[model samples]
Target: MEAPSFLDFIIHVTGLPGYLVFSWFMILVIISLALIVRSSLKLMPEGIQNVAESVVYGIYSFVEDILGKEETPKHFPLLATLAIVIFFYNIVELIPGFIPPTSNLNTTLSMALIVFLYYQFLGFKRHGIKYIKHFMGPVWWLVPLILPIEIIGHFARIVSLSVRLFGNIFGDDLLLAVVFFLAPWLVPLPVMALVLLAASIQAFIFFLLSTLYIADAINEAH
Candidate 1:
């Protein structure tokens, strides 16, 4: 059998290399998950309902604790989104023939850029043109020196967010594969549990940091 060509390889590798395919795949999964969660929420408690309740309540509590309850419900739509999408994508590594989308730079970059745009948009909504003041810093004369630094800092946000997520997910998944191959027994089981924990932590951290970014944008306007 021949190795797949670069185009074919990328079709599956870059998460959304082919927008239609990946978009459809992700949408179907998301909708299914959403529908399932919706139905479960409507019915009596049992089975996955309890699990769903725990997760939903935990996420609400977590967001409220960090961002305040008033902010939590309003802001958590996006925060909850990032957490769910990322956690699922991270766990994709466990499925045969499926790769974790977060492992790819392009996907991670897209996620980073989306979050970047979101915070910027929210800043504008909160501050209008005054949001630009954030880049200008405290004094007008210092604008020349500070403007470039601020620009660099904003751009660096994309790089840092994308790379950190990609590196952690890719490294964790790779290590698990290697361990499983070498031991092929009970040892990898514990490590696999660690992978799940790592997945949750990574998702929480991403959501938390994104919230902080939004909060900072608002704080700066004051």
Candidate 2:
């Protein structure tokens, strides 16, 4: 018996060998980042400290843009946690002989499911049973048509979130595979750089879209 693997970067779907190596890579990367950030905490700003501070401030500004001031801090922890975890999972793909945890549908779908549960939960908290009214749309008569659309739309979010991440990372791994197959050394160097860029951007997109979905589920709709 073996662990499952989808989107084999090597052969067709038929091949997906030992993935525990990739899993361990993901864990180690996360622990190392945690340790580094933990030890680097400083009261006074230094050179790279200013850079880090600026990045954190920038993330806050971005969150405030999507969530507004009153509620921005409410979701900050969730947002930050998702961003950190996804980014770590993605960056781990860079290590030799490793696959990104996020590159798997199960892993990515789990994260998307988490987002789905959270928004639905919050909607219930905010609107109670009235949240169901959201699906009926503003016009009562339209509920018949709109209900299915809304339901499908919600499910689509989960699919989109998971697939988008899995597709990008898996494609990244595939592209690298090609590069390695062709030249195996310095040729894939450029691909590795592109992977880094794509990984970060994908993580950012995941965070931004998650914020939008949560906000939409509860917003007043001005």
Candidate 3:
């Protein structure tokens, strides 16, 4: 059997699921870091503050490029928050003795549902009742066929987002566990490097898909 992570050991002692506990721990850590970075911000922007600013600006630029300046300001918060949270959740698995929250289907699904629902809400908000036309086909006669297909396709986004994140993270974690068990030394180093790359890519892909979904929702064109 694979060894229990540090949080898993805590589960044995505390009788709570380690993933749930560690998720809360990670949330607190992210919040604390945000506060510290905010408090230490300077006119010149050095150290952690500078790094944070760079990340935020990079995301902002990406969002603006896709969403345009007017829409970017309105949706940037949700997009930025999703990117940061997902990235942190993904990379947490790289730390020994901790299970990444993203590795859990529950966590990924919850985030996926959030993105799905939020964009749906934005669609209705932006276009009101006319948003139903998005589901309907280009021609009035095709409503029955197109509506179902569009609805199913929209729902599938939730599955796509959640499964992709969970599968990648969980698979990477399992691979690392097996590698460490067999070699327990230098052999795992390269695997760790690959995992790190996968983690970053998965996070960015999630963010990109989310932006596309939101764009589709608010799009004026049918």
Candidate 4:
């Protein structure tokens, strides 16, 4: 097991779960960062504003490529928010005396469930009752067989999204703990760097999969 975070003291005092407390901390951190960035924004985009704009524009371009210009505006907020929040949650493990909330299954599963339900809602909104045709397969005769399979597959996305993120982050934290135990000094530096890269990749992957799910939901081709 990993060493207790500084938040553990607060957790004990408040009788709150560590993940719950840290998750709220993470949200506060993100909100504070957003406020700071907003206050620093300039018309010409210099300093922190430039970096923030670059990050937002890069994310917007990515969404545009996947979702097209028209749909990108509608979906970019959720995609960008997910990517940024998940990235922060993943990378927080690098901070001393902090535990990443993403390392917990509950946090990951909750986010996955939100994505799953949101896309389903979008599908129903876009196509109404006709959205049921998505489960009926390409042929009308396959409804009975395909419906259950399709339902299972759709539900499986929640498991896939949640488990994949939770497993990776939890494994990363475990590895870090073991490494720190074995070598508490310079040896962990390289590992920390790799963890940072992995965190970024995982965040992007979640974003990409979410975009694809939303695209599938809104596409009339379904």
Q: Best-fitting candidate, measured by TM-score?
A: 4
Q: Residue 70 CA error for candidate 2 (Å)? A: 2.0
Q: What digit string (tens of lDDT, one per residue) describes model 4 on residues 115-197?
A: 99999999999999989888889888888899999999999999999999999999988888888878888645699999999
Higher-scoring candidate on TM-score, 1 or 3: 3
* True-vs-predicted CA distance for residue 171, candidate 1, Å: 1.3
Lowest-lDDT window of 10 residues in candidate 3?
1-10
Two-way lDDT contest, 1 vs 2, winner = 2
For model 1, the stretches where C-alpha displacement exceeds 4 angstroms are 1-27, 42-44, 220-222
Q: Which structure is stronger by lDDT: 1 or 3?
A: 3
TM-scores for all predictions? 0.80, 0.83, 0.93, 0.94
Off by over 4 Å in 2: 1-28, 47-51
Query: Measured by TM-score, how close is model 1 to the native structure?
Result: 0.80
Candidate 4: minimum summed lDDT over ten consecutive residues — where?
A: 1-10
Rank candidates, lDDT, best first: 3, 4, 2, 1
Best by lDDT: 3
lDDT of 1 by residue, 106-177 (tens): 777888898899889888988899999999978999999998999899989989888988899889878766
- Worst lDDT window (10 residues) for model 2? 1-10
Clashing pairs in 3: none
Ranked by TM-score, the better of candidates 2 and 4 is 4
Q: What are the per-residue Cα lDDT tens digits for candidate 2 across 19-124? A: 4345555567667865676678788876656665686688788889988998889888788778877887888767655667787887789889999999999888
Per-prediction RMSD in angstroms? 4.4, 5.5, 2.0, 1.8
Residue 56 accuracy (lDDT) in model 3: 97
